[model samples]
Target: MNGWNLAAAVLLGAGGTAALWGVTTGPPARRVIAQNMTTSAVCPALLLLSQGYGRPAYVDLALLLALLGPVGTLVFARLLSDDLSDGPPSARVLTWTAAGAGAAVVLAVCVAVGPGRALVKLLVTGALLIGGNIIASRALADGFQGVRGG
Candidate 1:
């Protein structure tokens, strides 16, 4: 009802719809990129919802998603490397754009939360989200050849 919830609803609805479409009906590489995008989109929306609902505890959901989303993406990248290796998608623009968005969202939340343990947690989550995103994108692009004993 409020702006935060409305924003979250819009993000979840629009972003999720796009991601689902991309993931469900695209080449393997495109699907991987879409899957990666879902994390960036949903995590921020969850943060907004937590604020909108005035539930600090709800932030935990966002935090966990920020932490685990990339792990899951990496798993997909690793497992599907062979499928992607043929033409490993190079989505540098998309990757950095998503990272920037994640950073912006985390900073916005941190500013709203003010300096404290919550701020530290938000910062950590932002770092993890961006760092993991970059790493996962690299893995997807390169087929993680280095990690694959190549």
Candidate 2:
């Protein structure tokens, strides 16, 4: 496989394994955080795979994941708010680290794509990914009480 594909493969293998392990074997709060991480982990790999395969269309998959991943996490956080209210997990470091990674991936892809409409799409995807991740993490940390009440 080419370097991009190889990199994508390695990332998907390692990150997916870790995310699955964390989600399956953790306490409620930890599980939620891990679930949220899956999006960040997989979206970048998908982006890499798209680049490696020379298929711009595959990028749409990553875009959709960026948009929907956090929504799913937020659903979990809301439904499990009662369970997490006891001492809501604050994975600030992990959250920011994931955001940084997503940002770096998007930036790298943008640089590779250069200035174009595709670049704009990548930027939008990156913004959604990072913003949604942060919002989901905050909801998890706060137990989503505000949302529940309103």
Candidate 3:
């Protein structure tokens, strides 16, 4: 098969799985799911597409997208809160801890998928993250509300 065809398949697979995950998991988890799916699919596809086309621009674009990963995260946080806590350091710690934990899970999933199976791994990882995030986000929002007396 041609390289472009392969890349298209990978992107489609990832996007499809992610979309399915988002639909199944509900709103709380959709963003994380989408982010993971896109990154996982895009990264490996870019690598292949770059090689096939004999151009480095695809790689650059992939890297740029990866770096912009925080945008969805920030949006998620904003959705969870309209309040800035002033009461305790503990609450701040919990917030940071939750974010850190979520990131670590994604990184671990990516590594476990490995270089060769990156695309497949990305698709599954995105779906899993979306599922996990849906549950975790709700729990976090609830916990934070308790801590802040909201």
Enumerate residue pairs that collide in model 3: none
Model 1 whole-model lDDT (C-alpha atoms): 0.86
> lDDT tens string, model 2, 29-128?
8898999999989998988888889888899999999999999998998888888888798899999998998898888888889998899988988999
Candidate 2: C-alpha lDDT: 0.89
**Best-matching candidate per lDDT:** 2
- Total backbone collisions for each predicted model: 0, 0, 0
Comparing 1 with 2 on lDDT, the higher-scoring candidate is: 2
State the lDDT of candidate 1 residue by residue for 5-66, as single tens digits. 99889889988998999999978999999999999889989988987898878888888998
Summing lDDT over every window of 10 consecutive residues in candidate 2, give the lowest-scoring window.
141-150
Residues 1-150, candidate 3, lDDT per residue (tens digit)? Answer: 665547546655765576566536645444443443444345445545554575544445545544444345445444544332322112234334434443544454355435654545444434443444444434433434543434
- lDDT measured at residue 5 in model 2 versus the true structure, 0 to 100: 92
Clashing pairs in 1: none
* Model 1 spans > 4 angstroms off: 147-150
